[model samples]
Target: MARFLLRRLVTSVVVLFGLGVVTFLMTQVLPGDPARAAAGRNATAEQVAAAASRLGLDRPLWDQFAAYFGRLFQGDLGTSVVTRRPVLDDIAQALPSSVELVLAAMLINVAIAVPLGVYAAHRRGRFADVAARVIVLLGAAVPVFWLGLVLQLVFADRLGMLPLTGQLGFGREVPEITGMTSVDALLSGDLPAFGDAVSHLVLPALTLAAAFIAVVARTVRSSMITVLDSDYVTLARATGASERRVVIRHGLRNALVPVSTIIGMQLGWMLGSTVLVESVFGRTGIGAYAVTAVLQNDLYAVIGTVLVIGVVFVLVNIVVDLVQLWLNPRLRQPARGAAPAPAASLAPGAAAEAGPAVKEGAVS
Candidate 1:
């Protein structure tokens, strides 16, 4: 297990390094000079040259790339060409909003998907299953920005149940504790602020969660269907175990391996997709910052944001691999060293094999 973990960690590092290289090259190759963008249209040739020199843009491209990587290795993300603020500081300031939004979306996805998937699997070939499938299709088909706008219209404009935009009500200051509005409001002992934050978060979170819920539900339903037909499930049924216990404890546990992988992948997608949702909802987050950086041609900020997201993707995959190994013991064991099967695979008194043997064990 230790060796497996070490190998995964090393692979993650290599992947991150490659991602960094790609980010650097892509940012460098993008048209339009950051110095010119920062300097504005009215600037003269000398002014542009000075700005370029100051930003090390006048240096050879390779030298600039080397310097950027050197600074990155030293934990310096460089100063933003537009804002002149440290890239790391800007990221730190913006990260919480993105993290909070993604987490809320994830929670909403799990809450809706798990139950819908379980019910769909339980009601296979019935109307419930058909309805669940239809919902998943619709969710997957709709664009997130369109969904966000529709939600804003229905819940905010028409129903008037929640605020249209912003993290809090105008002029109502919520103390920043953890940078997560909901968490910070709760930590500050302000129930009203907390309620407001959660209310504001609902539309965007739902918009983001909709697509992910569709993915997770389909994965869970498929895995559950496969698990439900296995031999152990038949044994549980024969042992007179309650249907609920058999489904929840036996079927669901075994089904979660694939479901977990889907969820992890969705989490990484949520991070990237939040950009569109954040823009539509007027939320201040890394997504919003990234958009601004792209508009202004701020190469440093763009590269830094991409690098952060790439690292997150690599880390999430590693975690999913570890979870998969933990859930399926067959994956963790040495394939060549496994003990031989018994001569009689089943008891003489036992009924005929009711189903195929499950290759993977239950997921914790």
Candidate 2:
């Protein structure tokens, strides 16, 4: 485990380095003058020149990159071209909102996906299973922005059941313990504020969770089906274990190992997708911040946003790997210079052949 963790940390550093370099080049390629964007449209040519010099844009490309990279070590992300505030400060304020949004979406995904997927696997060819499959396909197929719009129209505009945009209703405020409105509200013991915050969150969270739900549900369904058909599951059934016990203890428990992996990987994708969701919902988050930075050609702000996302992705993956190790103890054993364990098949008496510890571990 120590060796694996060290390798992961090294790989994460390499990935972040590559990400920073690529983001810098991509920003350089964006069409527009960063100096002019920074100086404003009405600024004279001399002022633009001064801004260029101040920003180090007047230097050679290699010097500019060196300066930018060096500043990173000092925890300086420079001032945003649009906001004229430190880019790092802006990111600190915005990151919590995106984290809150993504976490809420993941909670919804797990709540719906696990039960729905398990039921679908059990039902197999029934009408309910077919309907679940169709819903999953549609959720995956629909674009997030379009889904957010439809949800806003139906739930907010037409039905007036939810707020149209923003994190809290007008005149509803919570003392900011965290940038996340819902969490801050609860922390401050403001039930009304918390309720309002949650209502605003419903549409955006659903929009962000749609694709993730589909992906996770499909994975759970498939994994459950495979586990249910395994030799240990069959032996448990033959030994007069209740059906629910067989499914939950022997099947779902083992199947969740792969689902944990899928959830972690999907989080990385969801970070990117949050851009569209926040745009449609008009939420002030890192995604919305990135959109503004891109449109205004704010080089430092854009790079900062990508760096934060990349770091979060790497950290989430590390946690997931640890969870996987816990779920499968075999992963903890070094594969090098180790004899292979015998694999069991689905044939009768395979559980007995595999040994008592293996049989109990499979079911317990």
lDDT of 2 by residue, 1-364 (tens): 8999999999988988898788778758878887887888899999999999988998999998898789887878888988889999999999889888998898899999988899999999899999998998899799998999999999999999999999998877788888899999999999999999999998999999998888888899999999888767876676666889777877887888999999998787788778999999999999999999888778778888888888888889999999999886667876677555444233333354346656676688
Cα-based lDDT for every prediction: 0.83, 0.86
Best by TM-score: 2
Count clashing pairs, candidate 2: 0
Where does model 2 exceed 4 Å of error?
Answer: 336-364
For model 1, residues 129-235, the per-residue Cα lDDT tens digits are: 99998998799899989888998999999999988988888877778878999999999999998999999999999999998888889888888898788766776
Q: Global CA lDDT of candidate 1, please?
A: 0.83
Lowest lDDT block of 10, candidate 2: 344-353
Compared with the true structure, model 2 gives a TM-score of 0.90
Which residues of candidate 1, in runs, are more than 4 Å off? Answer: 38-41, 339-364
